[model samples]
Target: MYKIIIVDDEPIVREGIRNRISWADHGFECVGVSENGQEALGMIAHFRPDVVMTDIYMPFMDGLELSRHVAEHYPGTKMIILTGYDDFEYAQQAVKLQVTDFILKPITSAELREVLDKLKVQMDEERGHLEHLNRLKQQLNESLPLLKERFLERMATMALNEWEIRSKMAYFQIPLSGPLFVTIATDMDEWPSEDQGTDNELYSFAVYNIIQEIMDKEPDSAVFRYKGNKVITILSGSGEEEIYTLAQERAEEIRASIKRYLSVTVSVGIGTICRELKDIRHSCRASVAALEYRLLIGSDQVVSISDLENRRSKPLYDGAESENSLISAIKTGSPEDVDRSIGRIISELQNASISIEQCYVRVLRTMLAVLQALLEIGCNETELFGKETRLLTELYSFRSLEEIEFWLKDMCGKAMIGVAETRRNISRNQISEAVQFIHHNYDDIELSVKMVSSRIFMSASYFSSLFKAHTGKTFVEYVTGYRMEKAKELLKHSSLKTYEIATKTGYQDAQYFSVLFKKCTGDTPTEYRQKMMVDGA
Candidate 1:
């Protein structure tokens, strides 16, 4: 309802205006009546009426002055001026003050009714507009949760390009930008069994609410379900340290709350800070990767990639480069070469000047890599790494790295046997066997690429790639290198002539062997042997 205040010097006039019209019919309430503008000003402040009607000639403050004040301060307050004869000039100023509508002296009920009807219509439109804005705000609030989940869930699972990220960000009205996104993967420790009989949805939502209550207090963050029993929270802030601090603080709060109230343990895996939203999948993976350390670090702990990285005295070598060969070697190489290959990796770690702690970390990494490769080849983790498997417990119990190293070396040998039993992850194992064949037959003068590929049952084209993957060299390059090493061994330790050495190392034509040997080792067989003799002397 539109509220109205009547201001007049005459009491009768104020009552007459208040009672003359049916205010209810006109969608108005006569909230107050006053004898002068001063009293009416006080009423206007208190009631905040939408419309005001006042006589021009009042004590203390005239209606023209009141209209001027209301027009200046409360511009939205509509005013209809009251004037009598000889007050034509005051009416003129009222027009300049932009009063709503004015009536002359001896105001009639019909004329006042006409003004009230128009004011009622104006208030109706304004209130309806306000209601519309409110409805839109409510709808937006309802849809915000769905939009957040869609974007967060997608980011967690897949990689999005820059344009797609920007467009979705704009569409969802997320005010945050790139250069500082941190993903934290939070999981409940022993929760699946703890809450098995409870309402899953209610239980999850309760946990979610606790998550939001903890994470949303950060500068900018979004919390959503990452998967069953896990929720992902991505936070955006200024610097890497600041982001880490925020995520760490929030994670502590959540952990404490869950422990104190919920009686269950929740652990967090915080990733590295991403420089762009499009690359945030890396952060998500890192956070999840941090979770992989929960078992080593202990459950219900908050771990960061930096925390794990700091545990090691040096950076980890890209074991991925040698992993395929390691797996391949494990599958087909002799027990000695298999041990040597795993030793080579550990040797690399050992020579890097790492601390004893780093030795433990690298040993664990080596074992996990072997296990993951086994799993990739189609073996169940439980069969190999399940609770019943004593390898992990024994691994943790080792006192010295040499003992641990020896154990891991033997484990790799056993794992190769276990992996080869399944035949689950092959295609690359064929290349390993092809490599094995090449190593054994490099001394055969008739050995060729086609012959090796045929023996392995893999096409030459496929074998080429897998060989490069496993050996980091083409098949011909590996064969030649092996032959050159053997040729060098003969030159140093045997009295064999150059031509005899060439034929022994699988070269039928001595001249071609000389050229190939010179190309690979920068020396002909004779020159290499002479240099070896002099060095030996």
Candidate 2:
């Protein structure tokens, strides 16, 4: 309802106008009655009426003067002027003041009703427009948070090959003309919470404010909320060095700003510039991978991929063959051979300039390779893990390859520790023979546990337990995992239909294949492919 004020010098005129007609019926509430324009202006400042009805002639000030003040100060308020004399000058003054309506003196009840009815119609129209605008605003407010969430989720999970990424650039409406670079801002994994809590809105708002502050300072730049803590800021027509320097400087500023407001440390990884959005994901991947180097560099630091050189380019060792022999000797449990191999492997890695971290991974890979080869040479699988198989399962989360190498180093030390107390232990060579058989026949759709058991001269039940013990996976799980990995590679690289890929992966049923793929990937194959395309676009 529009609040109304009545202003007139005569108390009777004010009373007549206020009590004569039904203001409530016309969607108005008469809140005040002022003697003149000055009093009405004071009332307006407090009550702020939507419509003001007043006489042109009054003490202290007049209706025309009040209308002028309302027009400037409260522009939304509408003014209706009242007058007794048929004065052309008064009418001209009301027109100049832009009063909404002009009613001559001795106002009739019917004339007043018509004016009020018209005012009600105008108010209704304005209300309708306001309601429509509010609906749009409500919709945007609801979707902005979800949009930010979906954008982050998409950025975090989708893995796009080069072609899939290019297609996404065309589909998702990202700007593709300028040089694009990705900046990844990722939070470290903290202690687990009971809620498994996710505050998409708060994090998104923080990221948005950080980007906005940067763009606010540098008006010429374009910044977008790419995904999660990651934001893409494109600076056009700039030199690479200047762009990089500016980004590094702003990253520090953004880090400080986020810390002040959110109390969380954010690490930023900057990528090399690419000319299109299609390759921006590659840049994004590069930025994220740079996080692996964060251990050497510190946290809350801005590390640019363009700045780091891979230390492995320089050779640290002479004989790759001797390193292999050293690795091989250790697996065979020959103390003399193990000593020779350990020394050589370390020397080769040290000479190669491979970080202890890199050397560790390389050593683990070498150890696993030798372990696999030992099974071929009739080593017992049961002899590998002792009594506890779960220890093998925990190896997946080991940080640096060096960590695994150190574990192996410790394993070598332990094996040496017990050499004097050891009882006779036979190596399990049959498990490796089964693994070899599976590797050769995994593509066969009709291959079964029965066939493999018969071929390896073992009972089905015994072979099943042995397979699980050796691989930390059941026979069925291992084959399925292997096939699905192959299936994914084909789906990514080839234009095969769902049925063809299913068949190629040894799944006879396409629907079943889709179900399994979705179960593992959290997206159906079609949805996965479409999303990959969207990313490329």
Candidate 3:
């Protein structure tokens, strides 16, 4: 029920209003009675009454002054003024204070009840409207992330004009505003088996989570999954070189985290940095093209288009097809495939009817391709070719096509082998570091896979897989087993109570510790202590 306060100078008037009205029947209760507006202001502050009825003429403070104060401080509270016929003009002035209603002196209870009934309906309607607005705000907040992702994907694919891009970016609250922008594309080097549908989904989800978590730390960067397989990230900064460096660092961290936690490798490709917002789509395309170079570069590494620009030499004799086939074969195919690809390129050169000088240029271009592949796979060219022999000068001296083919085959074969060995030897040091961290921090009650993984700069999922593979137990199982062993030692040898032992072993609840102890060791903490003592005796 809404509460009400009645104020009047005369004692009889105050008592009559309180005792005469059946307040509960009219959906209100008379919470207070005051002799003047002064006392009623104090009552209003304490009870916070929804409706206040006051007399127009009262000692210390009048009804008009009280109405003004209530209108300013308690705008939601409905006010009614009681006035004598002589004070009717004063009642008219109270209307300026937004008084809900005015009753002449000696008013009937029926008239007052009608006003109270109307006020109750107005309050109920206002409350319902407020509740509806709050729900809409909550729903908008919940769907904000999905909406932002869709807007970013659209921006990356479509050629939106600058005005449209700016408007949409503002609407979605995108933080990017770039004098320089770079896009990075990432995907798993190899997908899980088709039959393991659930595992594939989990791995994809974990990869996205890792990228999102890392990108969240960098300002003006956004990461989202595209077409279910690839993750696209866009980063904006003030300078071109700074943004490129930042992108490379973040991409490498993403690659390492996925490899460390998921036990799987991912390839990252970075596009040329651009200045205009509309050209982000171009960067997106370039990044995907760079990802294709993973066939030559090997996986689980960052490949930037800018890095390839200086190393790659255009085919000198329209042998682009043959050159591409040779690079692919050397990186992925067997030794025989490399030999056949080289022969195809030589035949194309021989059939061109070009001069010996042109032939030399084409052959040098092919040699450059070989060198690029070797560099991509982290091979030291100086070691492969002795420090004394300049590869290009030696290639220039070779007089016959057959001689050049033999040399090309030998170099390409070794490059293919180098690529294979490098991939096979992807580092396992991250897992070792994770194990050391867990052992050192085992007594921390908040110790977790995420905490340990973060300490070693890896993703939690990747770290969990490596931890399981290396220790033959999940992170929680290993930590719990270690804690139980420590608890067992303390119970057997020390006089500490069970609760104290629980605290030492990283458990906050002694009762929970006792329960888990019995589950793991087939005896409660106290029981285990007694059994050990008896057996020793």
Candidate 2 local lDDT, 387-447, one digit each (tens): 6644335454443334444565666644443332232222145777777887777778887
Window of ten residues with lowest summed lDDT in model 2? 418-427
Task: Report the C-alpha lDDT of model 3 over 33-97, residue by residue, as the tens digit.
Answer: 99999988889999999889999889899999999999999998989888885665776687788
- Model 3: what TM-score? 0.35
lDDT of 1 at 92: 78
Model 3 CA deviation exceeding 4 Å by range: 1-142, 195-198, 314-537
What is the lDDT of every predicted structure here?
0.78, 0.68, 0.83
Give the winner by TM-score: 2 or 3: 2
True-structure lDDT of candidate 3: 0.83
Candidate 1 on 1-537: residue-level lDDT in tens?
788899998888889888887899988889999999998888999999889988888889999899999998898889888878556677678789998787887868987788788778877888799899999999888788877787878877798888987888778766565468888888776544534676656667777889888865664777888767678888888887887888888877777887787777777888988888877788888887777565444577888877777764545576665556677787674677776676677667655644445656666776777787777778666765455776557766553345555787777766766676666347567877887887788889888878998898878887787778877999888999999998889888999888898999999988998999899889888888889889879
lDDT at 267 for candidate 2? 63
Q: Rate residue 209 of model 2 by lDDT.
A: 72
Q: Report the candidate with higher lDDT, 1 versus 3.
A: 3
